[model samples]
Target: MREELLISRRGFMLAGGAALAAAARAGGGPAAGGVPNVVLCMTDDQGWGDVSYNGLKAIRTPALDAMAAAGLRFNRFYAGAPLCSPTRGSVLTGRHPNRYGCFMPGSPIRAQEMTIAQALRRAGYRTGHFGKWHLNGVSGPGKPIAADDPLSPGKMGFDEWLSVSNYFDTDWTFSRKGELEKHVGDGSDVIVAEALKFIAAAVREGRPFLAVIWFGSPHSPHKPLPEDQKAAGGSAYYGELVAVDRAMGRLRSELRALGVADNTLVWFNSDNGATPAGSNGPLRGHKATLWEGGIRVPGIIEWPAGIRKPATTDVPACTSDIYPTVLELAKVTVPNQITPLDGLSLVPLIEGRMERRAAPIAFWHNPARAGGQLNTATGHAALCDNRYKLHRLPDGNWQLYDLVEDISEKRDLAAEKPEIVQQMKTELLRWIDSVAASYRGEDYRRAGIPFAPATRPAGPATAPAARPRRQQRQQARRRRQ
Candidate 1:
């Protein structure tokens, strides 16, 4: 890929809107009109390359393609974690899932953390959640959630909800505001249709809305409509995606029809990486790993009134940023936000004032390893520092990749760049310590606390060699005391 093509979109936004970008830096207006109506749409297991805009020719995603063409496409967007539940936690709270003990797909989010929905509701925005909601500590097939379920969406700040426990397909049953309702038809389409009804009500009431439409298509049990499957030439996975695209098309169109398209900030992305039957394009690794493919997925933001122009960016972003970004956009602050949030607002980026991410993104899988001290001998952990990616392996070794040159990560640059490895490793380990502290509720209710690096004696900050990395880190903590 040409370097120019990879970055031309960002170039256009930066160059064309220099004044707007400058004004934004001056705390100028995405607030000029009032904050936008927000819509968050996420798909289950959609790959980074699933959409035609990213280069899938087998199945056409006209709706998604249109949205991509008319919005800010994220060339390097990522899921907060490789699994669904954890990434969902990050999106709602703007913190790493491990900070609240949401390690795997069925892990529950802690009650102490503040969610975007809750904050938006406090801001007077109508809040609703539709489709698969797995953060309620439930497993197995998708089922109706009881209103009394402590972890239901109603309990988490959404005023209204039509959701289930996990993945759902056509003819699915949903719990609408905690009432068991069996909905017939394509599940993707069904959820969007329900969301539109909510959106229409909000529009009629002259209120802004935060409608979260998390789709259950393309995950498994590919039961796409016959016409959609036929359109994909008999590929069930692609067919499911085809339906997802159609659902999004209708969503955008309906927003336009309601005369709210320009002011509605619509975000489209995926819960995690692609499944085996799907593709992640050139990215390596699959769902449940720390590689680009596992965490990276299709992402786009379309707010016609707020965006200076349609563009794309290579800057690395993830689901964790959603909470802070939306909050900042609405100018709402969480008074009791869990401390040490892993994300920052993307309003600057949206306004074209951000050329690069301000901080590196840290990703770790299997929080059980993060119990007392980080156990590196199991699961995966990696950090993305702009163009460079670092993985601290289970065997207590480091692997590095210059993503700009090698997106597939076929080569390790750790041997050649020892200094960079040492510096990033120090920061990564320090971050791990902070996360562990949060896990133990050390930072609970201490909203807005900044992430601080461990003030270790310089030479001892990074994990030592000889002993396993995890064990040595525990030993270092004991020695410090």
Candidate 2:
């Protein structure tokens, strides 16, 4: 039997319904789940400790805090990658970004890979992606691509999209299914309000919906809207965070008002760890490093009808888990031909049936080496077996940490735990071989392939500076040629 429920806008009153109603009225949107909806909300560069509930003193995140209280808080949750596009790629494909050729930020995920949106669409769900869609272009410092690129959210699978080419802020221009729509307001609010419209319409149509709400905030060039700043007491960054909190509160209230809060599964997290502008509490390292602070993110899963006790679980989890979990929840099946997924469903964990993952997890981040619009480099690899984590850097310097004992990864026990490190190293290498093998056709042979070379420190110049006479001669030679 198809389950159905009606959310009385009146119930929102108990949870500050007036404020929610006012917000809803001012924004003018549809109701919540007349159909099943999935809201996957991500904050760019937001730290794990940015929420007041996470020990952040300067910011207020009542809505996110409330969600944590009423939902499942994953203490060991991690982003799929330590950077934006890579992690976002993981969310879309349910596989490591490297597997699909998304090595770094601007790397494009092969359109062939079956995405979360594509999967949900196959299940008769109206799919939409609102906010940041960083998966389409090269990200590091460089030139921008033509706005006419075909592989955007519209090309990815979302039936509707309002997104920026990159992390945009303040009065930004978003492509609405290819046409541009200029929004004026806090970036966070603008994105959420746009998403609620899709949610409302899907509800009235009695159709299932998947709304991937990826926010562009707290990333860089920190600029908060006036109201958000006022709410956060003049701290521009705090204001950005406050805007997200209000957005969350509005989303939750809408879900309840539409009467689908119980059935809907709302997942909240960050693309990676916090940036330097953000605080990660006890975790060490910042956004780009391999440390916990760089990858470990604040993750919450809420399904009122599904999850029992407002609970907490320390089982290590990753964003890769999102695809599989949502697929299982929606009872959608992937074709046998679509390469097997890297993630396992976390339904068992969410339902309190399991305390730990049944299998070990692996991670990697290989810096890009391709040149021209693509000259980039940032490589990393990691593997986890139970509580032990092994990190393989491109520099050939490997480290191991017992996450159970060293959440911050402050101590490197690789030297002391040689036997375990060797075992993990073997596993990590074997997995890398497997992933690399998949990338290269089986029986494909190559020689002198260098992987994980030792990194040299920058001290004295290795080569003398180019002489002006030599440079002039080179230019003259080029002209003659």
The best candidate in terms of lDDT = 1
How would you encode candidate 2's per-residue C-alpha lDDT over 1-481 as one tens digit per residue?
1122222223323333444444444442222323346889999988788888789998678998998999999888888888888899899888877665676665666655678898888878889888887766535321122234556676678888877656766666566655555566677877777777677666656677899998888888878887778878788888888888888898888877666577788999999888777899899888877678888889998888777589988888888889988888787887643454678899888778887788667787764543211112235778875699998877778899998998888799999999998988887777666655434422112322332211111221100121244456669989999
Query: Number of clashes in every candidate structure?
Result: 0, 9
Candidate 2 runs further than 4 Å off: 1-36, 138-148, 367-378, 441-481
TM-score of each: 0.85, 0.81
Tens digit per residue, CA lDDT, model 1, 1-481 = 1111122323423432443333233332222239889999999999998999889988989998888889989999999999999999999999998887788877777766788999999888899999988887765567677676667788889998988878998777677655666666678877887787777667666677899999987988888888889999999999999889988987887777667788899999999889888989999989888889899999999999888589899999989999989988888877766677899889999999999999999987884443345443445678997889999876667999999999999999999999999989888888887887777667763664443332111121111221254455679889999
lDDT of 1 at 47: 92
What 10-residue stretch in candidate 1 is worst by lDDT?
455-464
Report the Cα lDDT for residue 351, model 1. Answer: 93
lDDT of each: 0.80, 0.72
TM-score of 2: 0.81
Q: In model 1, which runs have C-alpha deviations exceeding 4 angstroms?
A: 1-33, 369-378, 445-481
lDDT, residue 129, candidate 2: 87
